[model samples]
Target: MESSTEAYVYYDPTKQNAWVDAILNGLGPNKQRYYKVASLQLVTLLVIVIAKTEYFSAISEVETTSCAVGLMNMIGNKGGCAVRLRLYDSYLCFVVSHLAAFTNNCERRNQDFREIAKRVLFKHQSDPSLAYLSHAWNGGGDEGVAYLAHHGTVLDSSKQASVFHADHLIWLGDLNYRINLSEAEVKQRLAVNNYEELLDYDQLMIERRAGRTFPMFEEGPVEFAPTYKFDAGTDRYDTSAKRRAPSWTDRILWKKPILGREGLTQLNYNNCMAMMLSDHKPVQSVFRAQIRELNRQKQSATRRALQQQLTETPEEMAKGTISSSFIEFDDVQFLEYKEKTLVLENTGQVVAPFYFLAKLDEAQAIPPWLQVSPQQGLLGPGEKILLQFEIMIDASVSAPFNQGQELSHILILRLENAKDFFISIRGNYQRTCFGVPLHLLSPMTIPSVNAEASLTSPPERRKHLLQSAKTTLANPSDPPGSVSPSSSSSSLSTSQQANLPKELWRLLTFLWNKNMLTLPNLFLEHGDRMICDYIRKCLDAGDTFDPSILLGEEEDQTQEAVGANSVIDVLVAFLECLPEPVIPTQFYAEALAASDAPDRIKLLKDKLPPLYRNVLLYITSFLADAIQYAPAAVKQDRRSCIVSLFTVLLRPDLAYKETNPALAQLKKEKLISHLLSIA
Candidate 1:
């Protein structure tokens, strides 16, 4: 190896000018040469690492320097110096330390080594784009280790990654660990050039075996003589009366690299015989470390892959195609469903990844009739994947579509850098509401009354509440249930009341409660049951309640109805009872279309019968008016409820289709848009 002196200047802190010559002298003839020199405690020890500017700039490096106290005052300053570097594809960390010295003090030397190990923390400067590669280590047995790094300003200096976080680690310095033998014994072995025998008494080796020092470090065989305790200016051993035993104190070691893929072969491990500086002979080792060379083609491919991942623009992701733009099912039997698969092909030059999102940012875009899997994923170029879609007709879901409604959904498929694609999903839903009314499912409704008067009249309803109150007051000890009936207030028998739809009594009770039902525990405890019953009742009614009840009547009427606490004249009242609207308020723009449409009745009737269309139109108009009075928060909640309810109610089975498929499709689209709006 060729050697060149960049600059030759010894540092002496005791002098007035520690940097004896011009600092610029450190710059060699090659202006591209860069170097960093660090000193410990007034230049007691120095660590310097150098590399060509181009090479340094081409790699990532993070360095940490710390100093500890070990030996006599001015001579004892120590600590390891470390640098974490990424050369090509491999990460490497190098550490150099000067530990406590002297004979028979291996334990103290081990302690010094530990101090350096603990305090020499590396400040990793990892690339943010490669963040996913942070968890790079996945090994087994004693080699098992994991390293996680991130790009951020480290706030806590005390917390940093250790030197072991790299794929390779090299630790070297004047460790100051002496031999565990007498001077005579060491000389006896050295006289015969028996360095191997002397190594048996090596303090570093003994300390390591006792688990008091470097644990998993590996070192090459030391065939040469010890490099410590030599007479100044001579190749002879210490000549003083207190002759120090020759020990292999100055050394180099490293933990084996991951997978042993890279070998650290010591080509030359020997002591220098020429230049003499102090009482210690300078030791040198020539190593031929095997490094995995980067393959240009592979590297280019990797860079492309990473760059693609980093720049996730929709334009790139939009380059894909679906086997079909729409998937339609003729029917989905209640309580039963079939699974269908749709293929997505990556037709672009680059890899494509996509995800399914809710419609218009609603919590749920897919109707109850549909269930999808693998919400999000990635695809390679020209690759195809089958997405699963199952149509499930749950009884709870069926209740909302009790009239056998059509199920239509415009599902959104979003690509990373591309415009979103809409997949039309059409299916017929079969309705079966638990095969019975809500009254038959519970025990409290057996004695309820039949409110025969125009269900839309408040005065008639008030009379019923008064009669019920009187009847209840007549028996003050009766326990009040959420839907307990006022048996004495009506002419119906227990069986007759039980036979009526449970939703009827529920609505009546809601009217009796001054149109205010505390529903905090409504659907939570008995999941889906309450929602199913409410939906079933709404579908069976074929009628819409009067909006005036919820929007508020005249002040005189409000006062008069105080004790009356009656009348849920409009189906909108059921919507009012909900905390969050079935259709989200954000979609109010779509819902408003229903009310503003000049031919809304005819349009609505195309999908629903005249009775149902009129009912829906009335409710739609009421929602538009309610928006004017409802608070912002209430509007948001109601919007979600409205969408959810209509999503269930507006099924294709309920639509009166014409012979023309295009017109049928147009009618369906109009109905969906109108219903989704806030009208």
Candidate 2:
């Protein structure tokens, strides 16, 4: 509705008053009793469908906006209205908007929608005390809530404004996107009940494909006929001289919030085809949106407690604590899943906003074996939330801890602008064959395959595999002599490799390679050299490697499973795949003896070939470098593994077993310390 007095403004409440009154009067007594006006702005209206008078009374926090973006700001009036109300425990947002109109102005219409979206803001209108309490509980007041909402929720506050900060967002209005067909062609399609065929040419669909409108919104199929360009009081299409093509102008779309009820399901979406008071028929959509129902009485009690806690002294506010200072998982069976809950309570006055932060210098914030939920949140005073801490040592999760070392970890939880709390979490992972050396996997002393082994051997193995398969099928329980040794060896290798999951296999291969040659060799051959360069570039620049690429397909799943991320996740997986340390399980005593041997340096040097020695030295050095990227509290375990490796190499079991005991003890401390320092 254009303003009669001012050409600059399209919203004139004075001019809309009479129309509003007429509409209200037209709604008969029965209809009037069922519906109440939630908002009315120039030419745009929002009405809540209520079953009873008490229903209308439950609604709260009404917000409205009218944006004039028409020519000279006089003809078009884009308006929006949003109401925030709690449907049980779920908060709902109902929005309505009117955008710019015209057949070929879809881009302009999109701009109008964006403007309305940015301008429409909903103010929380709950109890003043509760609102303040929630904000306070958010920890940093408004600032804290805003920050947490950005990091923990789907809504991005740093980007353009949006009304998606609700449990359910239902946007309804005249979207004004038209059909991309001529009037005659649109009618031809409509006459044959081929609405689905017409949808591809729908301007709204076209704009969506072009990424110009409704990025993440979902709307029901337009099974019903188009609602625009109809004659008043009739179902006939536009018969004007300037024939307007039929278009689904008025639309109802919605976005289900990420942090809310299950989701929204469409019950019915169709047009009020019979009513034609204007050129546009009305569109109505009924949705069965899931709402979480909470006990109001219990919530009120919690709020009261929160309020009481808020008024305590600053000293009390600084004193928050968890149910226990340490959580001991004892022993989690490898490749088995177990979960323990840690109850964190706000022991101090005021709200405590808490989030898990990885050690600043560590590549991964949390160990892969441990998974935590609700990475960040706020807790009211005396309020306790159960933090689920899980240990799942599958091939992927165990790859990093494969070395023969005890599984012990310390987790740090930080409170908003407060002291950090340490939670000692430790678990013993069951042993597996994944990370054990080839010789250690079975009693057989398998010869090492040289790096110089023919690269074409894989194809040869495949050829032999076919024959091996035929032999097995021909005689199900054949004797050992039935298959040739090479064929048997290939079959055995294939079977063992197949049993290991993809993640674990890669990890084990990386860890067992005494030298760090696998990476360079693989990349130098098959992988793109640019990727290698990129890694070098990132490292040289002191920039963190992009884990998104390393995790690849596992990125999303891993992030969903664990609260932490690391650039060396793949490397860590390799470590976890080890069933024993680089130095075998029964070699600890030998390692100690070697560390004490007189003339141990020469003895150790003579035991390993130059190639093997270099590889061993490389591995130890690489591990030592990797420790800097590990969490501060967990670095010691990594160092222990490295030291064990160094000990085994410096004091070879064969050489040290026969050493003079007195002489060994004499040089033990100094030589061992020197070796450890270097390692």
Candidate 3:
């Protein structure tokens, strides 16, 4: 007896009847003995499946299903033909498609591919009688029986079904993407047998490089000549007047499931030049594929052995050691990133698998801003792994930290079948001007308490002081210099009153005193992180700036100062972090609509609250000074820079639901430009 083989065919019924009949007849008498036609679906196109009779028996009893999607003439003619089946423990899907034709229709081809992948639906056949019996055993009533009878087939209802769920997928068809070169150039390249040079202009390859299509699919390299635009029944190129450029329109691509361990290797990819009945040449690929099989007896035995070993192991054999039980990070500022490394070692003789335990109310083992790489892993005896802990404070989660919330977390690392270790992570979240309400910051006075003394204070006393500060800000009627009872002795003197926050004034004064405004790219690029941190610490502590700290003892007199860029960064950060923009939200539309600098200035003064108006005028005045000091050639550049930087900072923080955010942003830039023209 001959070995059984399977044949799947997808054809246009309008034109391929004779070819189909020929293929069916060529199968011969032995085909009937070994094969059976499992499915025949006819839409505008036809999908015919012929499988070996012994194939089902060899894989045990299960159902195989097929689905089709039509993409021509409103769900007619050409599209995708798919077959899904389970072989052993693996689910495989095979798809064939005929995409859009022509050289410039590559986007259409990609659209067709995406449509077929999304719309193809496969219904798994279920035994209604079996379902009824199971329902009855579970004490279900007539409703369950009626449901089974009404819906005989079960559709896969997963968020993503069909090809996306398969363990291994193979897709092949005439995708019809043409080469980018002109016909004359293509012919010249082909004459020289420069396949590589010609392929560089292939539209499909270009699309893949741009990541517009076939992002996860892999294809074998084409060593053969173009398999398209040939004259039927001849090896010569097309001789007609509409000389189409030769392209590798026919293609075969495959993707491995994200988590599947199976392997697929393409051994050969070539075209059948001898059979030239159509303008397009027939292409084929041979693949070596791996399938998984399950053995229940062996699986059970291994599980039992593992269980016994776990139960009988001595305590010392299961122990693991962590490098540290406590990790302390330096002061974290808004939009700043910090990282630390923790080493984990398996000090045991046996393998150890460990995972972090989440708090009872939390789903994640760590906080949102804190990320732990390799949160769970297995380590062999004497093996060590470095675990990285990173913290970042971005806009989304900055409000709490800016409001004096501490940055701290505790992680519970549990060794499977062993003990749990506690690791405490702590960091001081420095307060910044970014997320504070303008009104609260305007009249609020910075406490004169020593930062080091505050750090060493009792936790309860610190908590009380932070809460009192927030309360004082929350109540607008409270006197500006009101101090929390706990820190009355260290309260700010009335002489320090200012219309704007002290932090903002300090940043501006530094820029002015250091002659930093004319520095190029000062606001455009990031500053030295170490210097920035020191600046932030001083600002938070309300301490006077000590140039010596930054200059160092040797103070290589010739060395350029390093804090200019950092000061600018901190200034921008403060403006961006403000809970409300300097231009209040309610007047955004009116401000953008103002026609002239005088009109914008009038609107700013009239509509903005007193403090907000003060801040806008103050910042723009500094910008005007910067431009005035710039060289004649760079004055316009300086003005443009100020407009660019402040446009985003001063705009309201409302979400733009406009259809075009770019247009709205342009309007804001125009408004800022008007303001800068007269500043």
Candidate 4:
């Protein structure tokens, strides 16, 4: 079979659109051998054309005219073009898109693809002059008859006009997916022809695996070298200051047709390395597609025969059963994993294909923390499958849980051609100090052990307690002795006027009193889990540490004591876990600048919040003492290690790390070291 070819060009208005005629004239000396089906230009960025050979035109017809959607001027940059062709009774859609560029804007590119897919509309062409005439004249006019013959009402509605409606879809163009590695790292790997390792870091592959972009699309193996980021007219990479990392920005990807249809097999996929007029190399792909042809009269007769047979002997309905309608997990802790299993069984004689459906207006079928494996599947009669539901809370999603939002959802279980079932999932998220704002945590009193038990109480009672606590914390001006409605019986009281949180002070004093800072690898290694949990419980309960409970008759009283490192670890974690660091991120620039000034301490103190100022001073003072008393053998390097450790704990926010991580980290270390010297 002869291969079908497609091309895309950037539109230049100044050239008087000569490329259109050039493309048509270049086809061949025999003009009647090919036909132009559609042509469209979007803004000044994209030009698309669809043409077919004389043999193909003789066999099939053009179903719809070309449609273009521009995402550049108003919403974003770049856009897409789409057209449909019909061969026998099957519909095939062809799409060419140019997505957003740059490595950091990968999410933007994904958004562009979704926007184009959702907004592009294919409509039949009708003369505007006929709409203003009489209805009777317009209804039976020659133009209306011509329009119906050439471009019939192919799509009933906007929803049905999407690319997914076609029997076979082919999507190709400059996708602009970049490599996730640094420029130097990409160059090092490419030098040795290490395409396999480089593909692991490809942004497109990573996003595809995470189901964030192009969820069901498939691409052939990219065995060729990087197809982007080269010096124009030369094979060497970009020598400019930008130093853009090489990427597979130009490529092709396709989604298979629906079930019961033949699939497409990729024949060839590679790049044109010799033609380097632009920074990006040109890529091409060929596929061997199997097309199914049908006779309309015969197809209609067969459908009627099948319907007559179905009426004579009715078919059984699909039915299924679930192990439970309600699933509850154990109490969830911050950064901890909790999971539950659900069993789905096909109880009926017929095959049952079930899927978890998302609620209306929601992007995902399940919440970010909760994951349902095998979201959709088919089950044979008497077949059962185990569905694992798991939940994990990390910093990105901890804000809502810490704000007293309940962890629960109602998932809709849908069976094809059957009724839908609702499954209720609920879990108790234990509140912690980790993700709570400093201002909010400062005004709230620690609940007693019995008050903590209220988290597991009935829904109404728990809601009342959480609402009262939130109300009390919202007013930072509340008096020190004010008590929340839920915890009025407890001895603990709010201290809105405290300079620093008592929890932080407790951890700091324990490390100082126990001399745990002198221990080797003091914050470098993790501590015992049991001891760390004990320290956390004590801090939250407003109770002092009990050496008898932690040490348990060991009586060593030396640096070798097992609890020493644990205490230090808990202290550092306390500071690191605070929603805002000891030195708030907003003041980072000022602090770095102040490090070189004569009155660095005074400059920083004036700029910092009272709570932050006090916390920074208290921790640095303790570190100064530890450095002074360090043993001679390790004293020289101890200060530097301490600086590095505190730099990480104090700043914590590294959102800008991708730009120049090493330089930013060095600046932070210098600032911390200067603070320690003065302390």
Of the candidates shown, which would achieve the greatest TM-score relative to the real structure? 4
| Error in Å for residue 534 of model 3 | 5.9
Candidate that would win on lDDT: 4
Off by over 4 Å in 2: 1-37, 43-51, 71-76, 85-90, 125-162, 209-211, 291-293, 300-679
Q: Determine which window of 10 residues in candidate 3 has minimal summed lDDT.
A: 1-10
> What is the per-residue lDDT of model 2 for residues 246-268, given as tens digits with 9 covering 90 to 100?
99998999873343236689999
Kindly report which residue stretches of model 1 are placed more than 4 angstroms away from their true locations once superposed: 1-43, 69-76, 128-133, 137-159, 209-211, 291-679
Error of 2 at 245 (Å): 1.3
* Tens-digit lDDT string for candidate 4 (566-674): 7766666666666667787766667666666737757666566555565566677777777776666666556655665576445635573435543465577678877
- Give the per-residue Cα lDDT of candidate 1 at 399: 40
For model 3, the local distance difference test gives 0.61
Question: What TM-score does each of the candidates earn?
Answer: 0.39, 0.40, 0.42, 0.46
On the 0 to 100 scale, the lDDT of residue 528 in model 4 is: 58
Scored by CA lDDT, what does every candidate get? 0.50, 0.52, 0.61, 0.62
In candidate 2 the C-alpha lDDT for residue 648 amounts to 26
